[model samples]
Target: MDLIDRVNEISKRIKTLGTTLQTEEATKNALIMPFIQALGYDVFNPIEVIPEFTTDHGVKKGEKVDYAVTKDNEIIMLFECKKFGAELSPGHASQLYRYFSVSEARFGVLTNGATYMFFTDLDKPNQMDAKPFFTLDMQKFEKQEIDELKKFTKPSFNLDEILNTASDLKYTNEVKKILNAEVENPSDDLVRFFTAKIYSGRLTQPVLEQFRLIVKRAHKQFITDKINERLETALAHPELSVKDNASPSVLLNEVSVELDNGVVTTEEEIEAYNIVKAILRTKAGASRIVMRDTKSYCGVLLDDNNRKPLCRFHFNAKQKYLGLMTDKVETRVPIESIDDIFEHADKLVETLNEYG
Candidate 1:
């Protein structure tokens, strides 16, 4: 299987098992071991992946780490595992921090089975940072995230690849944090400087207050407008057109119809159905996905996409959809079938329209 398939499988397993491994040992057995296996290491082989791994020097004797990965007798990576639901805070891995200082390991991983955070030193050699350089949440894995994660996989593991980008990720994150703070609370000096420029050297309490409100409102509006523009771009695909007065016969002939029952009836439905079935088949947990139709509306119900319940289908501003869950739904895509799902002509269109 490819990385996407592997990630989808892992996501299903993680969801089925849930993130609640009762004990630290169980977490090591269930979460950490599988992660090592994913990296192509034999968990049972001490030469590749060793448990209770020892180091040459550390804070105290008998201080064993959860796992250590070795290559040519040199420890290449260190991992510290916590109970599944345990928070992966700095305090959780103080022992790993001490062991890192004396080990030959260049990379350290802290995971709670559900969340993995990869860490490395930037300020000093062999000193691990409290914050992770790359993080992956097992619950909602994305394509880009999986791509970055492939770097740590044993076959492609390269220290230079990780180190070369660590500084940029760290500094970029730091800059974003600082900018976010400024956006929330503008500094007095910054406010005064801007006030001087705008008011021509006049500073007043009422004026400052007014300027603060203005700045806040401007910032909020800018973000809102940018978000709407992006959403429009994402949703404006030609393939995502709504057909006026589309009947069931037209839909069956032109588009695909996948039913809630596990059966593919029409030639178009069979083609499109195969695509969606293939997606949910690998991950049984994704079986919450269902399809149905009525006189007015025909659509699919996605229980959760990326760990959130997506909203119902509403095509042509006439077909009203009522969801099983009455909670306020957000982030929904409306379409007749997979063929008309995207904003542009895609493989979905090619595959489904072929039946017509």
Candidate 2:
């Protein structure tokens, strides 16, 4: 199965196994090995995947990192493992900080076999930062996030490509945080600039008070306007034939269905459509799957580029009519909960298996 499916499956497994296997070794055995394998790396290969990687850090002897992934005799990635149930704080990354600077590794990962945080150097070249550049939580998976994570997988791994965007990725997030702080509370520089610009020669106590109020109100209004725009974007695409209520909770529930001719139905069919879309993304030959809105059900339209008709699941349509779709089309079984997407994830591999 692909990285996305593997993440989904491992998340479910973690929930099922619970906190029983909470030890450091158990985490390595249960979660770490599986994660390495899913990335298309051979866990059994000592050359490629070296566990208990020893490195000299000052006076500390027998100091070892959890694992180091090497390619062409050079370390590409370093991993520092923690106990399964342990909460990972910035304090736990001291080892990684030391190892990252000493080694040739461009990327560093801190994982408890569940949450993976990827870090890279932003301040100094060829070094790893203490803070993660990006993070992926197995407990909560999203399609776009999975796509980003796939860039690190063994098959697609490119050190130059990763390094190329490391500076931008690392600094963008830091910039955003600083901007948010400034927006929340204006700094002395901002106040001085605005004060000088608006009240240069005609400044009095009353005018200064009025100017402050005006600036604050204008800033608040600007923030409010931007927030409204964001909310509109989030709620932009209305559910076709589902419901037009303004309540977000209600909309979220009805989002998976399409009502037809005043008949509310087709939740199952929509789920099947999602499955097919997921499968299509895994196929290298397949073009973008354009899903259509329907009154009674969603439609997975054929991409002219691929010229391949994938399966259709008509939730409201009769079973006999469902077979009317092209015979060459592939079928994917429907899954219920979003968490259950991992159940038949192998089908995704089947779709991509032909690529090679």
Per-candidate TM equals 0.58, 0.55
Clash pairs detected, candidate 2: none
lDDT of 2 by residue, 1-356 (tens): 45666787788888987487868889988888888888877889989999999999788767899999987788988899998877886578878878888898988889888888888887677666668877778887555456567677786678777777667766775885776665667655665568888666766667666665666677777656654553454465332332223333233323323222354324465555566666666564233454554564445554321223343344553331231133455554443443354454464445334323
lDDT of 1 by residue, 1-356 (tens): 44556666666777777546689898777667877788767788888888898764633787788899977677888888888888887677776888888888888888888888778888777798878777788876544466577667665567787788778876765775676676687766767766777787467788888787667676666656654443453366432323444332333322322223333233333344344545444443434444443334334444322222322344435432222122333444445554553332243233223222
RMSD of each: 15.0, 11.3
In candidate 1, what residue range of length 10 has the lowest lDDT sum? 303-312
lDDT of each: 0.62, 0.65
Candidate 1 lDDT at 114 equals 84
